[model samples]
Target: MSNDHRRLGRELDLFDSDPLVGAGLPLWLPGGAAARHEVESYLYELERRAGYQHVYSPALGKRRMYEMSGHWHNFADDMFPPMRIGDDELVLRPSMCPHHALIFKARGRSYRDLPLRIAELGQMYRAERSGVLGGLSRVRSIALNDAHIFCPEDQASAEVAGVLRLMREAHEALGMGEVSYQLSLRGPGGKYGGDDASWVRSEELLRGALSKAKISYADARGEAAFYGPKIDVLVADPAGRSWAMSTIQIDYHQPERFNLEFAGADGRRHRPVMVHRSLAGSMERLFGHLIEVHAGAFPVWYSPVQLAVLPVGADQDDAASSFAADALAAGLRAESVHDGSIGARIRDAAGRKIPYIGMIGSREAPDGLVALRLRDGRQLDPMPQAEAIALIASIAAARSQELLP
Candidate 1:
């Protein structure tokens, strides 16, 4: 019960909430921003390697777009009110699938481009009630790690399974403890957009994917998104709390609403099934869970300050600065610490959860060597400064969970 994100988030200066800014909107501090940049860059690279075409869409869309996507009818309560422009209304998008649908229809597509995977690390706003908002866990603004895969209906199952694997891989790399799957379905009395037949088809496609992937999941009714049924990935944090950290939704309704079409093998236009997924959900939710589970000491690659160079005293400050520069040149996040006594500075860096502390004492400085100290209290033998920098850079580059590879 004590592993509250709000408790450690403030302690680590990751994010802050202010009354003037309104509830449910938290500001990421410098340290938090650095950590976030690392995480986002990793996600983008991972997506790129997997053949996803990254795209940028605007934060606001024409009000008619949501109406066309059916979010206006079924999900209006969760979305913010539209802004009035000159003879038009623009609304902050609550989801990216609608925009991606427009992208798919922007040009004629052939069967050669069966699976057009589009990804975006984008933002969405929610009109969350004041009483229900807390920390980064439940925020008004969400930066989603989202993608939409448009493919033929016959290939939907395979695409869903592939996304499930991607989600697991991402969760494991992020140090999320135990990842589980849930099949979220439409239940009675919900303002869902799709009809019974379409909902059944969506649920069946998702179920086929789970079976194909050999994944076991629990059924959660009324947890489905307004547009379709989804498979939700739950991460059980260290505190024994399970949170929904990722999602894969199979949607047939949006395509029908938007009339998305592609040229088929037989020279006929066909509808493309949309598969919406977010590997690690939103940045706020992911970091909130990470803060509580990792307890402020993140994995080496995503650690805000990967290496903090510590000089034994003022006499060794020059050596420390030079070593830090070497690490920075190697693309490792490094900073030279020279504000206080050597022991005090070491303690400060360690307390801040800096992964590796390169110590430049009198002996090491004279010989151009360094001593590496891990956050977990392991001390490596003195080695050449380049060797130490390589060790640290290698670990960070590989995104290894271990402090030392």
Candidate 2:
């Protein structure tokens, strides 16, 4: 592998794994944690605005839960071994949908609660062969921005349309506005659940939803989940590589198996249509794509350090510190480096893709001005500290990948 590809996670200080912990698990470093937090926060806000009620569930559940959800039959090979807890068997959750369904059952919902959207930043586990475990792209332990919507059968199309809207909004926020959609339908299968009618209706609803939204999508047969058909959103990277980042699936079998029902307007018990949607399919995969897409040069809004202040010499330390403080106060990520030469400092900042660099010296400090250098080394005329701070903050807010000059 080239240095650019191999050293991304290391250079960005995102994650690393060790043999002592076995394979497929990563130890996230501080920088990686910050990036994860920023993305999670963004998703939380977006989901909240869409009226999703956030929930949490345990990492392990009774094996019977998987059996009831039909994951044990079709997906058991990817799941970890069951644990013997006295008379009961437990296994780590491979997906959050089963647990979320239990929550709906716990409360016994009604038609008044139709279109109930519940979301969770769920940490899931799976057993993957060592060969497939790579950086963050493929891992054993993954976090999913998972959500489930329980809408009446008649309202399934509209609820799915809302999920598509949310998915598009998320992609645009992450600077992936060119994302495309794929409609993955079931093929003549042996492992998949449900009969012909179930698959047919689910596919029609998904197709109708996409058409009503006026979004263009491609169809792919035999790519659907064992229990449902789905629509996946694929994002194009800077290198023109495509990554499947999100999915919205319609499940007609699970609700019936779980005996989940809600009272309709006729005071009759009805099976609620279930939609499983994830804007960020798996945090691990998303992070891996991000590293490659930006080439480790994250946009200011996502950068751990958006700006770096480089002092010309030790004598300019105080001025550099002042500039850094101002930048931080204005909600711009900033750092100061006074131990290195001006050239070394510039090179370091450039290597890390820091969006803005401020140089402090006797000439600029005494006049309350700083020499601004962008990531590309283009020098901007010396400007007052406030203007520089404002410029950096604006760029960060706008999520501009290129530095302001």
Candidate 3:
């Protein structure tokens, strides 16, 4: 009955950590991986629709690259030690900004390419202390839903606003609980990069964007990234504790540091501004909150196992198999269980938090129908197998919160 994701994760077999594999790194089990893949696919589709060009970058970047991005200077303590191979010291990137910067610099750009949006679901590593590590919440290995937008200075506000809109949409679909926004500022005595005027302009730009979107946010000092100020998305868990899940930062420093520039309408070389953002931050940490908030019963859209098919004894095996095949073909996460009695199987499915249970029996099998048993103890009358599958598919496709129509 615990709401903790670590407990629920183990109970539902979503993920697990092993001593041999070392602390702070978790192994995503099949159920967990399946759900993750669905969410990742959704992000890719959403970003693509929003004009983001996805790119694949190597996991390791040279140490000089991090230094150029100011990560090695500011976050070196939290980053893993550089692996020395021959003359080059390669480090697992702590952030995707540098790699993305390299991508933006790979080609000449014009004002038309002003808001060049580049995205990646990339891997990063942190050298988190063992004591601070637990489950997926704080991990060494991370998969970040990261993106960078290189746009003209005038378009920075609009880009920030657009990121906020995208974040809201993603939060809604993912069932993130009670999300709040914060204007994280550059406070005193931190290792923040850039000049005071840059910080002030960045803050002002973010403020304009938030005001334009008519979104309310609280101001928090000293939480800004080393490079610039950010607008953070915080989600409250079931226990009423707040965790920062996503962020959008405006960086003028990186372009200067990397010497990133584009040709303007006047054919003048101008430094393009960089917008750093993630709609959903680390996949592992996001799911930690998700599992806790939902108590292992995710929304139908991303539920690890949406339908559990149980045939009434050996008589309905063929009918159940056929239904399952149809469900799979429709891109549904479905499973058929027949290793036990009907009652036991139903209970098993219920325990796993399966949203829909299709019970095929002697009477329903001949007609190619199924009786639906919902996780909430509702029973639906027998209906055509295709109709039931379609209904389930629609609910998932819509990312509906309801388990029943």
* Top-TM-score candidate index: 3
- Report the number of backbone clashes for model 3: 0
Judging by lDDT against the true structure, name the best candidate.
3
Question: How does candidate 3 fare on TM-score?
Answer: 0.98
lDDT tens per residue, model 3, 1-405: 388888889889899988999999999999999889999999999999999999999999999999998999999999989999999999998889998998999999999977999999999999999999878888999999999999998999999988988998998899887888999997888998888898888999999999999988999999999999999988876667678899999999999999999999998999998999999999999999999888889999999999999999898888898899899999898988889888899888988999999999999998889999998899999999999999999999898889866
TM-score, model 2 to reference? 0.93
TM-score to true structure, per model = 0.97, 0.93, 0.98
Q: Estimate every model's Cα lDDT from 0 to 1.
A: 0.89, 0.84, 0.92
Model 3 lDDT, full chain set: 0.92
Per-residue lDDT for 1-405 in model 2, tens only?
332333788876777788998788888888778777888988998899999999999999999999999999999999999999999999999999999999999997899998899999989999999897767767899899999998898999988988888887777666654678899987765489877898899999999999999989999888899899999988764446666789999999899889899998899999998999998788788877777767777777777777889889888899899889888888777889987678987888888777678888888988889988876668999999998888877876665656762
Q: Candidate 3: misplaced stretches above 4 Å?
A: none
How big is the positional error of residue 274 in model 3, measured in Å on the Cα after superposition?
Answer: 0.3
- Give the RMSD in angstroms, all C-alphas superposed, for model 1: 1.4
CA shift of 294, model 1, Å: 0.9
Looking at model 2, residue 131 earns an lDDT score of 92
| Model 1, span 1-405: residue lDDT tens | 466778778877888988899899899998899999999998898889888999999999998999999999998899999999998999999999899999888998988998999999999999999888878888999999999999999999889888888887888788877778899988888888867888888999999889888999999998999889999988765557677889999898899999988899999999999999999899999999988778889998888888999898899989999988988888888999899777898888987888888888889999999999989999999999888878877887777889876
Tell me, what's the RMSD of every candidate? 1.4, 2.3, 1.1
Scanning candidate 3 in windows of ten residues, the lowest lDDT window is: 235-244
